[model samples]
Target chain A: MPTFADRLAEAVRQKGPLCVGIDPRWESLPKAIRDPLRDELPEERAAIGYFEFGRKVLELVRPFSGVVKPQAAFFEQIGPNGMEMLQLLLREARLLGFVTVLDAKRGDIASTATAYADAAFAGCTVDGDSFPVWDADALTVNPYLGRDAVEPFLTAAKKADRGTFVLVRTSNPGAGLFQDLVCNGQPVYRHVAAEVANWNAPTRGACGLGDVGAVVGATHPKELAELRAAMPDVWLLVPGYGAQGGTAADVKVAYRPDGLGAIVNSSRGVTFPFHPDDPDWEAKIVAAAQKAAAELKP
Target chain B: MPTFADRLAEAVRQKGPLCVGIDPRWESLPKAIRDPLRDELPEERAAIGYFEFGRKVLELVRPFSGVVKPQAAFFEQIGPNGMEMLQLLLREARLLGFVTVLDAKRGDIASTATAYADAAFAGCTVDGDSFPVWDADALTVNPYLGRDAVEPFLTAAKKADRGTFVLVRTSNPGAGLFQDLVCNGQPVYRHVAAEVANWNAPTRGACGLGDVGAVVGATHPKELAELRAAMPDVWLLVPGYGAQGGTAADVKVAYRPDGLGAIVNSSRGVTFPFHPDDPDWEAKIVAAAQKAAAELKP
Candidate 1:
């Protein structure tokens, strides 16, 4: 199997570096998807709705995007059934030839961290055969617990030809409250970015990008540009495009001049382009994904 | 419904401040637990073993400890069946009158964060009847995502009379990489501690602790003491004891003079003290939990 970075680079060359996000919020989903849910249980119904919405998003965006980053929380909200739904969606992403990044932000230490890595990357094995529980091509990791917390993820990803994106500069409003704090004469995010760069060496691909990636939010263009240079070997998963108020121009700063280093993502803006009542929702979603893909071209 | 702090305080007063961690690693499990493998699959047997081990531990420790902190990653590794096992174990904790602090480390932004909160604290509502998912009394959160990622957790915790403990100065060896970085003349974890203090105001209890708490590792005694002083109203969930190399004296710093603040946790040291081949495993586990409880006594 090719390294995740190599596979990602090939995918990017085929489809512009757009990473469509599948974030299906229960209340915001189209009634068309929600109405036909089989289970009477709200969580079950909502889980079904989320799965179908994700399936549709995959179908629409597979032609235009290199990656599909599914936010874990949206599916996790509905409990076990939701997780079951998420597992299927992940397998679907692989089957459809799209790079799947499970945006779980999972972080821990020792055996616990190893368990998370196994679940997300190499997956759980039974007998001689292995089952891909998440089977994600890559994962978004939190570095708060430090290196030991993230090492298992890197080790597992490397072994499986997968990748991981460490959170560096997030796009949320309160992100600056902690990330901007000056640590060692520089911002905390910079330190995180530096570590991300160091971790990349273990699985650096022929494309000059490493399996270890960095999540640099498009909300802070200046920081994004700075981090881009700081972690040249790192692939940046740039969120905050579209609905998060980050424009395409803001996200462009994260990409290299050669247009092969960053993946700009749009979730609600692409998946739920219309109100809940819209009749022609799927087409609009496809159109929105296309527009996002074109606009995000570096 | 009493506030989470109120309930926690009562539980602690009745059972002391020991928080036994449920870390069901496969290899370390007792021979008796793993020997009964009717299933052909390893993960299936491992999942069953983990669930049974958790059940036995809950039964043993419920009499001596106020809380049980189940490491989420261990259960998540076996797919949705493992999650179902975890859900059952969480329910078991509730039935046994122990406050469940799910060590999920889940953090995200906006509605995604809200979804995680609902899954952990508020419980997912389906068919007009709300279904408790993890339904933990409190959760351990990763603060690397900043305040917005943590806000929904606090809000839902407040609404549901639950609680959360945001990671401050972790006990891991590489925790200093970013956490101890001097930002704006103070460490990054200090800034995180300050924010935890701020978030606590929304759900302060009569005992003076708040629904929003801090996870200060036992390995970092000085920082734990400093963070304790910095956030007086915050409930601290201190991990990294025994098996993680932190002594009882190190964890003692997190407690208030009144003996009512921090909850010290012990995982492998308590849960898997005897070798996997030990015949009297239950007795050993009980003894370990007891010793840990006594050592962590305020």
Candidate 2:
């Protein structure tokens, strides 16, 4: 099996580093999609609507992007039915030849973290029989729980030839509450960045990157450049592009000279470009994806 | 509706501070429970076994503990079927008159955070209809994303008369990697603890404790004592008892003079006391819960 780093590298090389995020909102979905599901049960309707729309989005954006990230929170909002849809959508994205990243931001310690990682990659084992769960190419994790906690996810991912993105510098306005605190003459995020660099070292692939990556928001271009320099061989999953006030130029610092080190994610900007009532929502998604792909070319 | 703080205070007063953590693993489940589900599909079998085992554990431990926390990662390992079982299990736990805490450790920013919070508390809303998702009394949150990320959860919980427990000094040994960093003459966790205290102030209930709580590990009794002094009005959910090697005496510092400030958690210690092949597993579980309840009494 190809290492997760090489798979991601090939995807970015073919698709120009644009990762279209699938963050479905019932209120933001096109009227045509929502109107038809009005008579079904609330969760059922939302699940069906999200799955149908997501499946369409996959098809529409496939020409412009090679990676699709489905935010777990949005699908989780609708409950079990929604989770079922999320599972199906992930499988669909994989079948469509897109590298799927389940952006769950999950974190914990020991066996608990292993459980979440298994669900994201290896699936469940019952009576020696294995069943696939999310089976995504990668998952997004939070690094607050420290070494032992984050190590479980990395171990599980390596066993399955998958990848993980650790949160270092988030894009939210108040993200500096703890991340920016100066410790030992360096900020907390820099420490986290240093750890990520160490973790990514042993897993370096032929693409000059590793299976363990760091999430550095595009909203902070300075930090992005710093982190890029700090973790030269680590892949970067950059959010905060487009809809979150980050421009193409701002995220330019994330890429290496080879254009293989970063993948810029645009969730609402590319996926929900159309108003809920827009009749041409599919075309709008296609156009937005095309624009993002062109603008994000490293 | 009574505020979550008051409700929790009432429960602790009635049943002491033992919070039973339901973290089911297929390999750890009793042979009797596992044998019956052998013919079902892997995920289905695991989900069914977890739900059945969880329901039994709830009934068994109800007389001993008023608060029951269901860890989301274990259930999620079984995929959507496991999540469905989790929802049913939460409903069952609530119906049995236990204060349910969903130990998801979720964190994100803006609407994404709201989506997770809404699922944990207010349920999902489609059009004008609302449907309950997890419906736990409180949900565990990771505060690494800072103010905006944590506030959405607080806001959602407040709207539903629910509560949240933020990770402060976690019980894991490697937790000090980032949480113990000294910044501005104090460790990072102390800053998080101060923020938790501030967040808990406005929502103080009649019992003097507030809806926003902090998770302080029992293993670090010294820090637990210090945090208890720092956040007088905030409730503490203390994990790392028993199986994690934290003695009852260690967690005693988490309490206030009135003994209403802390709820100590025991997962594998209380739930998986008996070996899988042990036919007397039920009795072992009962004895463990009974002993833990008595030992943990404030």
Candidate 3:
């Protein structure tokens, strides 16, 4: 099996840098998807709707994007059954050859961190028998708890030949509250980026990128470019490209000359481009994903 | 129902501030718990073992503690089945009159953040019908994403009459990697602590503490005291009480003069004091909880 970095690089080469995010919202889901499950229990209705919509979105976006990220929060809001739905969607996404990144943004301390990592990558072992959980190719990790918290995820990922993207400069407008605090001479996000670069140093794959990546938002073009120069060997997972007000031109600087250094993500802009009442929602999704792929092509 | 702050204040008043953390590990479970489920599939065995052990811990610690924190990572490691077990444990803990804190350390951007917050409190609404997910009385949130990210949690928690504990200064040895950087003449964590104070201001209850709280580790006694002074009106959820090397005396300063400001969490020290082979595991747990409760009483 290829390293996570190589697999991601190959994905970009085959289908451009577009990574469609499957962030389904119950209210935002097409009526067509929601109406069929109306008679079931609320949890069941939402879970099945999310799964069906996610599966359809996966099929529709397959031609335009080689990587898909399923946001874990939405499914989790529907309870345990929703988590089961998320598991099924992830399995289907993998079976369809998409490099799935579980966007759970998990972080903890020591052995606790190891538990979350094992769930995301290697699966759990019970009395010597192993069972896969999320089993994502990569996972989004929060870096707030510092080195010990983040290292477990990196170690687990490395052991499983998986990957992790650490949050650097997030796209949210309020992100600067703590992330931009000038620590020493540089902003805090820069410090996090430096650490990410250090973490990515030893795991470089044949494609010149490592399993450790940095999530630098497209909303921060200047900082994104600065981060690109600072971590030349790190793969950048650029979110906020479309719905969050980041344009293609804004994210173009995130990529290396070979065009394998970045994978731009578009969630609502690609998956929920139409209103819930729209009859042709599936077509709308296909068109949106196609447009995004074209615009984000490196 | 009273506000989350008042509820916590009442708990502390009745049973002191000892918050027993239910972090179940398969290998750490007593043979009695694991042996019964050995013939089941790996996921089932792990999930059932966690559920049974967690239920037992709740019953055993009921007299010594009024609060229980279920670490989501440990249960999540067992997959969706484990999540269901976590849900059951939370329900049982709540029913047993223990104030439940789901220590997921969840954080994200905008609606995504809202999605996570809703799962923690207020449940999810589908076609006007709401369904509870974790439904924890409180949740542990990561503050790295800044203002907008943390506010949704506070909002949802407030609406549901629940609570939140934002990570300010963690207990890990390498927590200072970013948390202790000199930002604007103060450490980064103090900045986070100040913000927590601000967010906690409007939510103050009769106890003079607020629903928005800060997580300050017992390991850093000096910083814990500093944060205690910094956020006088905010509740504190202190971890690293034992096993992680923070003595009872180290956490003494975390509480206010009135003894209503902090809830000290002890995971392994209270719940896993005995080896898996020990038939007296339950008694060890009771003794540990009793000792911890007696030492930590405000």
TM-scores for the candidates: 0.97, 0.99, 0.99
Off by over 4 Å in 1: A126-129, B126-129
lDDT of 1 by residue, A191-266 (tens): 8888899999767788888899999889888998999989888999999989899998888887777778999888
Ten-residue stretch with the least lDDT total in model 3 chain A: A124-133
Writing each residue's lDDT as its tens digit, candidate 3 over A1-298 gives 8899999999999999999998998899999888879799998899999999999999999999999999999888888998999999999999999999999999999999999999999999887788889999999999999999999999999999999999999999999999999977999999999999999999999999999999999998999999999999999999999999999999999999998899999999999999999999999999999999998877
* Residue-by-residue lDDT tens digits, candidate 2, A67-168: 999999999999999999999999999999999999999999899999999999999888899988899999999999899999999999999999999999
Clashing pairs in 2: none
The count of backbone overlaps in candidate 3 is 0
What's the ranking of the predictions by TM-score, best on top?
Answer: 2, 3, 1
Docking model 3 quality class: high
Per-prediction backbone clash count:
3, 0, 0
Interface RMSD of each: 1.7, 0.5, 0.7
Q: How does residue A44 of candidate 1 score in lDDT?
A: 73
Lowest-sum lDDT 10-residue window in model 2 chain A: A34-43
Candidate 2 share of real interface contacts: 0.88
Ranking by DockQ: 2, 3, 1
Per-candidate DockQ vs. reference: 0.69, 0.92, 0.90
DockQ of 3: 0.90
What tens digits encode model 2's per-residue C-alpha lDDT throughout B1-298?
Answer: 8899999999999989999999999999999999988888888899999999999999999899999999999999999999999999999999999999999999999999999999999999999899999999999999999999999999999999999999999999999999999999999999999999999999998999999999999999999999999999999999999999999999999988898999999999999998999999999999999999999888
Could you say which candidate leads in lDDT? Answer: 2
